[model samples]
Target: METESVEYVKQTMEYSRKRAIRTKLVNFVINKIWKVPIFYSESRAEGISSVQSDTDFMFEADGIFTLSNEGQIGLKSDTSVVYVVMDTHEVHSGYTRIQIMEGDWNDLSEFASSGDGLRSLCKTFGNHNSKYLSNILVKQFWETRMKSVIPRQGLKNEISSHGPSTVIRYAADKDVVEVDTLICLRGEWPEVAKEWLERKRNFNWPTKELIEEIKAIGCNLVPIGHRLSHGKELELEWRISFSKAECLLIWSLNGTQTACIECMRLFFQVFISPKFPDLFSSYFIKTAMFWLIEETDSTFWQPLNILACLDRLLSKLITCVEEKCIQNFFIPKNNMLDAKAVESKELLDVLRIELTRHDVTGEEKWRMLIKEKLLQMDKNDIYYYHILINSLSVSRHFIYNSIRSSNIKDSKDMLMQGIQELKCCNDKDMFSDVCKQLQHELEAILSIVTFCESQSDSGTDRILSPNDTKWVEETLNKYTELSHSTGKLLLCTFYFYIERYQEALAITEDVQTRYTSQVVHYTFWNRSKTPRDDHYPQITPRPTLNETLKNYIALDVVLLPCLSRLFRATIQEKLYSRDALFIHPLFYAFFVRFHCFYRMQNAAECEAVLNKMQTFVAENMDVLKTTQDFNILHLGDSCHQLLKKHTESGNYFKKTIKSLLQKGEF
Candidate 1:
């Protein structure tokens, strides 16, 4: 039973490891788009998939430098640059006070010079003539600034402050994660941590090469002050954060070690936190793990001995609490524990009881805890589907944000790599099946876009050759095998583009008859609820995608003959909108149908199709009004104009079609 329980725990950690890989892959794409220094922190990035964990992100402040001394600010004397010199005198260990050295006050922004900002935070030392920036005041200002800026970006979450970070607590109705973002300043490696670099170790958990790499990465100054500081020191001191280094260290841990850390965190959160409230923090648990890993032999940290490891870690935690001192891993002089000695004793009592309940061995007690948590979680196919869905959702978000701004080729390559990695993670499950379908859809979209680009390059008389038509048919067949409505609609557009009116009209009529609410539209967003189908009953909420939505194609798949010229003109005129490039599948199907009728000189059929489209639009106006679903008004007006022309004069309608085709415009 012990071996089985430990194996189960290890298996659970594998799930989390795969999740972390997927998240990192998405983050790699996001980092490319933002082109800034951003770090994902805490549980999500650390391979902990606990539902209770909040997503933490840190953005390094731009144009800001933290130097060890004024001498280091040699050539950065430009007015646009802000520099602060770290002062370690009389400060707590693992903390420093930064003094503004050189920069225009305006560089800090208008708020910094205002009475409510830095002016209010200024304080003169008793004997010194200079003033230092107050960590507390900086944190407060950033919190206020973030709260104001976030709502402007359309995130109306409830924003509040926690330490140096701004917490965005999403409402229950919102399908978003709770996020904590911190604005930090990068600095050179702190002198206090030099000892950790050279510290003697019995077991080299983080090898010398790792230490050197971490040193090169340096540290960041968080806005929060040391908790143990008094008087003005409390407001002026900044804590030295090794968040980047800590992340690297956690990533270096083997499977067993990582699983042990997760279990320690879970134990603390589920068993200890509710009873002991603020006596200790999750950081204490992490810090203890670092020490435990360094002190124990590497061979002992294996899968079969996870329970033993957890027991040893628990013993370490109890020792720390009893001694009332949990040393910072990087700076040993800094005790992380507070002065709540009585509470510590009580917590130690609880830990002792839990570790040896009913005369149970410590390893047996830990095995029971691991088994209990695993039972509470949905450790089945559903969990794997959730990971796959989240990965696809993030990838979609990346593509949506970068489609217009970044290179299309890079976006496609990244998405392909992501899908491939996801397939490797779960080869025989629903996860792999969904990935395969998505891959096919992506290839079809790419083929259509490539064809459009070829047409644009070949210029005016560019008509589809026999080979091109055959390729289109093949792509459409493949896509249709996976998705009927979207694939057939795409084929219908291709037929209209090639002037095959009867073929296009037949496809539209067939699609209209078969279209239902069950047909999912390809869009930038993913649906929260899956379609109620008999397939994949094990994964209730599986994600589905119809097309690889890219900016290169107009209207999801339609690319006009003069698209390049028109796109350039649109960009120059600043008349480009995402709505112009994308339309709902239903709207697109009707739009193509209306054009087909206009081309064939069927006034009655055009009018009838226009009325049906308008009716559908009218019925969903309220819902459409809330979202950017389909620009029904825009498409409806275009169809109405075509209908008007068909009714006015057949000769003039024929002339209109000739003029549009001659101009190579849609």
Candidate 2:
């Protein structure tokens, strides 16, 4: 029975391992699109789907450098450089004070004074004394800046500051994923953690090579102080954040070791947290896991011994609570449990009782707890998957919107990397399929846009060569099995571009008849209210025709740079600022139908199609505006004028189409 229990735990851990792979692949794509360097927090990055873990992101601030000593200041002599020197003297363990060494202070100053240039970031003791920057002030500055910036980026959520990080709560109905972002300054490896490199470890968990890599990676100084610091120290001290190093170490851990840590975290969240809210935290559990992994033999972290490893971790936690000394993994002198000592008595007693039980009853109790935790994780898996898909979709949308002629190669390289990495995770077939579909679609769109740019630059006609038509046909056909309406509509656009009016008209009629509300025209402008139900309805849900249509069929027809010339003459300069508008797939279908009729000289059919489009726009105006980036109101007026002018003179319609075709505008 004990072996069976361990086997069950191993199965759960295997599930988590697969999830971790998927999470990393998705995050890799997301990170590539981010403009600044970012570090995803440990638990989420590691694919621990426990609800207790919040997704945290640390962004390194640009143009702000941190120096370990005055000697390095000479290395950065640029007048525009903003830098701070680390002052480690007389500070708490794992904490330092940063003295501003260069740059114009007035540039950052909101209140200008006669002596604004001489003003310090925080406070100065004397005229000759160095002005030390305050961690509190830095945090306040970032929080204020982020609050002002987040809304402009289209996130309407209220931003708040929590310690060193800014928190954004994305609330959908009752489900909320709180994302914490910390802005920090990168610096050389801290002198305080240098001893960790030389520390004796019997197992040598983090090899010398890994240690060297971490040392070379350096560290960050977050705007946070020690919890036990006094008033002045609290304001002045900056915490030396080993988040990057910690993430690297966590990433290097074996699957069982990672699972063991996750189990310990689950134990803390379920059994300990509710009763003793502030007694300890997941970080304490993580620190204990690091210490245990270093002390124990590497083979002890095998799948069969996962429960035992978890037990050992719980024992270590109890020891920490009892002694009130949980040391920081990198800087052992910094006792993580120091501030929580006052609240540890009851928690210590409870943990000691829990750990001392080694009998069958205790074993059975743990089994029950593990089972319950696994069940909870299973339930939350859908929600986590929803978040992952949404994140991937949003990242793709951002990448597509940001892509220009200059960055096309870089964007393509990034997407290709995502595709290759996603393909390597063979165990996650469904996830890989969905992710690959998205990647291929984006890659296709990018390739077509690039091709269009090249053709436009060469002053070629819009007509496709035999090879170009074959490639376009093959690409559109790939989507046929998955997204019928989207593929047909894009194919229709291709035919129209090549002046195949009969084929294009037939496709438009078919799409118009088959199009329904079920087709998902995804845009970042409006998020689906029921993301879980719409995208991830089942665990390992197979990609059905309808599911693919809902998730993968973005109707991203507007992204074709070749098609942009067709609408460029109609759209205003203000609308052109967005480069391309995401039109409603249905509206685009009818719009294509109107074009086909206009080209065929069927004025009655063109007028009928225009009326249908007008009705569609009128009925779904609010929805279209919310879900698409296009100016439907302006488009409607343009269509109305075109049709009215066509009725006034047949020569005007014929001449307009002729001029547009001759100029390769369509």
Candidate 3:
């Protein structure tokens, strides 16, 4: 009974050894054919290593074997053969065995080729038993398996009809089969996504940090996908395989590895194509402008590179804009009115600011062209009116700042030409139209001063506000005798400048009370005309003359308080000493400028007028600094918040002036 038990135990040991060998063989075969690294299972048993061992031989055969072991296979006709052994029972002897198959020369080679094809045939047949095989392969493997491992229908038969049965079967349970089948689906992803994910996975594409950013930007995926293809495809296209939401998420979060023009184009393409086709061109153009503008501010990067890119983008954008407008059917999804105008204005503001740093000839030319375009925009088009006006003003200021150092006399000529264009429009019927022309002329004149200052110290002194002053004088003179109420109001401004205060007061009062029915629409004058004749007199004016102009001028008088403050500040700053020098004439010039601002009833215009005044102060800042006078400082301080601070002062002044201007109010 003990002897029987020992024999049974020995038999069990043999069986375990055989199982280990087969397992290794299966693993080796899979690695060789699939090129997938073999990871041993925890339950796998160790096997003897030898070329003829089932595992070793089969695995190597996948790499180098040329024939099947089950067939009459030979390397050469009637001479050579390869054999493999699967068992090892003789402990002292070489456990692996080999056998040679001999055949006719042609038949031998044909057998070898057929035998070689058997391995592929087995893979096609597939094994449901091996856990290793079941776990490693994915659904994607099926396509490759079908293409290479399996022969076409009727062309090759996997089952043998009459031969040594080579089909080795190990019992596979239902659970094992199901596990193997399901394993093909797990840990599997699209090949395209896999490749992209592998490249950027660790580096972080569509990172969690970028979640909010991804959502805000729609259609950002196109560029990102195209970029992943290294721009082999147009970025505008979306791969149909990916859901739109997924694509968008990827796109918004993906950042370019570099920022060259090509990359920028691709980056721009992602969002532009999907979310904002209509706005794409304009935004790109504006972005280019911003880049160039920033480059102008500092030579932080290569300006030439930026400029070249800008030119390309702007050209493309211009074409797109013209095309969209022409098509008419291309309504922007954003419903933004005049997108170009908004972009141009914003970009131009930044550009104008940045231009203070560069002195390049090319930069100047570019700036000039941009300014010219702004000036050319229609005054009636409110979409661009204010922005264009601001741009023009800034450009004019920039030009004046550069004019002094300019070697070219043509600069001055060009500025004068702009003035001429504006003057040509001054004959229009509308008061606003005439005012616009005159204002443009004023801006042009201011540009001249800046231009002269930029040219040279010698030319700096030549910058005269006198030209604008002269124009103002002429405009006032021309309007003084005109029958129009606006013209008469303009004449009162002239009186204020020439220091004819009483006369100025008289004209204001006449229009205020006598013509309140007609001119009450002009709110300021009606308010100014309500008091005594000593300070405000009701002059003889009929139905045509209006109080609006007078009230406006009177309200303008509120600015005097600010002027008083500014003068006092100026004195404190020693802009002028009380007893040292004459100051009335200079103050008169300030008055005339203030009158123009007050008459317009435009806050922005008034601010612009104040800025010009500030410019004058800045021009003479050195002089003021030297004096350190209290009176000048006071004056400067007075002007600081003139319109805003002294709102009620105008009303009181209006009451006081009523008696002076009135024919009968006193």
lDDT of 1 at 168: 70
How do all models score by TM-score? 0.64, 0.68, 0.19
Q: Give the distance in Å from residue 476's predicted Cα in candidate 1 to where it truly belongs.
A: 9.5
Error of 3 at 503 (Å): 4.3
What overall lDDT, based on C-alpha atoms, would model 1 receive against the true structure? 0.61
What residue pairs are clashing in model 1?
Answer: none
Per-residue lDDT of model 3, residues 454-541, tens digit only: 4345553344355534655565555433322344444554455435556655665554444432221111101211222233333444
Sorted by lDDT (best first), the order is: 2, 1, 3
Q: Count clashes in each candidate, considering only residues at least 3 apart in sequence or on different chains.
A: 0, 0, 79
Q: Give the Å error, residue 58, model 3.
A: 73
Error of 2 at 314 (Å): 1.2
For all the candidates, what are their Cα RMSDs to the real structure? 10.3, 9.5, 39.6
Q: Residue 422 of model 3: what lDDT?
A: 42
The per-residue C-alpha lDDT of model 2 at residue 605 equals: 86
What lDDT does each candidate get?
Answer: 0.61, 0.62, 0.30
lDDT of 3: 0.30
Q: Estimate the lDDT of model 2.
A: 0.62
